[model samples]
Target chain A: MGLYFVAKRFGVFLVIVWLAATLNFFLPRLSGDDPVANKLMEQASLGGYAQAGIAEMVKVYNQHFGLDKPLLTQYLNYVGNVAHGDLNYSIANYPRTVVDMIAEALPWTVGLLGMTTLVSFALGTFLGALLAWPGAPRWLQWFMPPLWALHAIPFFLLGLVLMWLLAFQFQILPIFGGHSPGAKVGLTVGFVLDVLRHAVLPSLSIVLVSVGGWALAMRGMMVTTMGEDYVTFAEAKGLRSLTIFMRYCMRNAILPQTTALALALGQILSGAVLVEVIFGYPGIGALLFQAIQENDFFVIQGVVFTVIVGLGFATFLLDILYPWLDPRITYRRS
Target chain B: MSETILRVERLRVAYDHPRGVVRAVDDVSFSLRPHERFGLAGESGSGKSTMALAILRMIKRPGRIEGGEVWLGDTALSGLDTDRMRALRLAGIAMVPQGSMNSLNPVVRIRDQIGDALADHGVGLKGRALAERVRDLLAQVGLPPDVARKYPHELSGGMKQRACIAIAICLRPKVIIADEPTSALDVVVQKQVMQTLGRVQQDLGAAIILVGHDMGLMAQFVDRLGIMYAGRLVEVAPIRDIITAPRHPYTRMLIESLPSLEQRGGLRGIPGLAPLLRELPPGCAFHPRCPAATERCRSEKPAVRAMGEDATVACHLA
Candidate 1:
């Protein structure tokens, strides 16, 4: 909560990001697969080129990308380049830089995943709180079975079902891609509407499958919090039912839910991988999927590095905000 | 007494168990005069706390006020609707709570907690006025004004209990139920908190029902004491008369069980445990443990009979 505490938390964040970057640099190399050689061999096999000069071509390409350097030297250079915000070139998409690709794809992922995560969290938390509340309507109990059923189904499977029903059978929403195939890419109302329409299916699947989890966790917390003595005292104080429900019960119960929200938000880049792939939305999840399939090492490293930084930053913000949420958590040493 | 401030007649609180209905507080009756300090003392599971909660119509689900009437002045609390009952609480009657450690919301500040009770009861105090009222309430409970900014955890156990008392007296209800209010504090702090409660009660002229098991504290603090056993009140008498001449066998044994400094000897304990409400003896609930229980006591329930001035005992021999 203090400047010193914030500085200390930022220090921890830097250390975590550095460690993640190092892991990113080493993990792909540890896979022991020569991506460059594999690409050239596949091209040669397809084009019916002689295999004799392929070794020479591989050597030339390795030198060009500095892969021919010693492992330690390559690591040092990678770290130095990362410090300068250069993520190197993508092997699959040869001339495009990883940073450029990420910049182009990051907004779509953040917009869709971020908005959906918040919406589901708020909806699920409120519903869950109501479910545990004795004063809530009896009809709210009927939602339990259906919510659990939706939670049990995977988002990607739900995505496919929705696509089959709404997109294929009913022909109501778009089937795939982030926008219309040849629409003019601008900030026009038509362009934004197309993007939103495309986002609907993926967002729905994500929210539906994930809301149950949030609701279940929140309900459990609410039940426990409701049993707390403070809640009874609040009622004894003659507070309005709504006041006791929100300020006394839901307020305490929502603390752990906020923690979960932070973790969920941090994982937003990776969480939508399957859903994005299913819907063919032009988000980071889809880009990461493609990168993984094509063995694009630089792009994969960049995506993973971004996720680590995002998570560290999120937890950092939580640390700063936690004292405000629960006053007992003080930064000053006793 | 000019007139009773609060009267509870034949209050029955029962819990619906799978096997049978458990009468936690069965046909218990008592009354408190204005500015009176009445104590309800009994062993664990003796329905003291249950009756206290029943008085406020706060018996939770699975347990309910099966039949009874709690009258505060001209209003019958038992017949009031939910909204009316809620509004009456903390203004008509308030509770000091049994568990002070968790009675105050841990996440909220003391100022807001006290302010909440005031604002809910239509005090209409805001900003500087609210803060001033909170600080005054805290000071009345012997707490520092700075305690208003602190959370429950920041304060000590006794301090938390004082804060609870502060909230209870914010609207100066006619009746204040301090249910085992000091059960969690050290002996030293317990005395201080009780003294604070006494001062606040005198200032408000509110009748208090101090529910606790500490007979020594009860003898010192309460003007009158009621003994409960197996969901029933066995005796109700003035503190001095009960201490000097306890008519009911259970009351006499409970008084004898208290460690006395002048009589240095082995601690005296009652012969048997308090009876379970679900399977109590047909006649007197305490007959099983009564040294002088007779055939009449074992077969017929004794009605509360009048004793010498202002005392009542439900013992056939008495």
Candidate 2:
């Protein structure tokens, strides 16, 4: 990869993020329902109050949120604010900024989903490689059907089942939430251990469901790679079985798998929505879910924009790392 | 050193398919003297490459070494365990694989590719020593020392083939099998690579079994030649004898098929296609294609018998 290539890829990344942010800004507004007005109306009806002065309240709220301005002006202001890392404030949770909410939830999402995705990728890739390898144990073939079954089921559904079996029936683990209800949030070992304990069921469900996909993809790649002339030549060179398996077979096969992993990691924020909701883990997915239910446009926009940037960043890193992974991949303009 | 460095005794290789077992290499026997160049020439699907792979005990799945033993020096390759066989490979008997374009790992540097072969076989060279050895190997193959730092894709087709040859000779194996090693190269580069191969074989005092369909190349490079038809070696003789007074009818046709400056005429190819291994003709596999096929040649299989001190032919007419 060259400097020019890096610059070109970075330029593309910026354009993509900007396009995504613009789409995010316009999509919800196109729904034609004023989330602020809707929230106020729902609140008034729940409290059994008259709907009088609702128009006045809506106008006041719109002005305060800078929504009273022309569309272009509002778009410009939104882009500027986003550039400065200010996501304004949540519509439903008025006093709380979207940035604040995201900051609190981002770590949990990254910790849980990030860890699970990597573990599943590594474990699944190895298993998949072994599955296709002729020398692998015969018993490994037995893992195929069960893995496919687990992969077919949605992670949230798997989470529910695991929760029902382990948490509800046997009570072997915490049923929901990120930690014990009364535990203090800190860097203490006890607190960390408690968080990990709560993370177990959600991570298990995710790892189980996703591992099969990685394995299947890896196995396909491995099979094709195994047929490559280089692998045969490597064997003819009399390399150790382990060396051949790792360097020649798995090394080449893992290139496409790494690309998938980067994409998967980028999608982790949005993908964790259902899993986090089920586990009651305070991650961005759960935050986005709560924001959607309450019609908090700022939080939704903030979360979505963050995911777009993350995905673009992931691909950008992939571009930078690609030349290293496979020497044939040159980023030269030609 | 023994008179014969590598001896392949009654080697048989079969592929198990849904329809039937395809005998790719059937009871083929040959041997190589030290510092000798033995060429195995045959048309496509004639089990020449299979015999070469079987010699290395590298017949892949669905294909098994059904019978016979490959003896490199005094050691029987079949009796040894996989680790032992692997150890013997590149150390005792290395192979310059066919399809050199994709033989070297595309991502790996030439130096590492060579170094790994050395390292795996317990060469124990590291850092500067390994680097120097790799450069030396590259130089010996007529490649620039800088090629050691380049990846396979960075090198040209001929360069890649030379790199493969470099790797094959890295361990100074007793026998090197060049299986159509220059099949993918043009005539010019093919000649250069073969010369490089010949030079390396001489330097190492190792015998070479050159497997290819090019009779011209075999005649030029090899001391002796074996003609394979279907799944059998129909003629095994000195190159000069095989080319000048070919014994088997198939060998005669193969020699005649080669274009010559001396006789300018229409090209002549063998009359029929090589028989399918699964359903070979009842007699000699070459009988259908043989120009001098007789009633006995069509009905009875001819065992390989010595016709003279220097040659053997599996033809009843001979």
Cα error, residue A156 of model 1, in Å, equals 1.0
What DockQ does candidate 2 have relative to the true complex? 0.84
The regions of model 2 sitting more than 4 angstroms off are A48-55
Which residue pairs clash in candidate 2? Answer: none
> Which parts of model 1 have CA positions greater than 4 angstroms off?
A48-57
Q: Write the per-residue lDDT of candidate 1 for residues A17-60, one digit (tens) a residue.
A: 99999999999999899999998888888986689999998899
Model 1: iRMSD?
A: 0.9
Question: Second chain of candidate 1: TM-score?
Answer: 0.98
Which 10 consecutive residues of model 1 chain A have the lowest summed lDDT?
A269-278
Positional deviation of A256 in candidate 2, in angstroms?
1.3
Best by DockQ: 2
Here the TM-score of candidate 2's chain B is 0.97
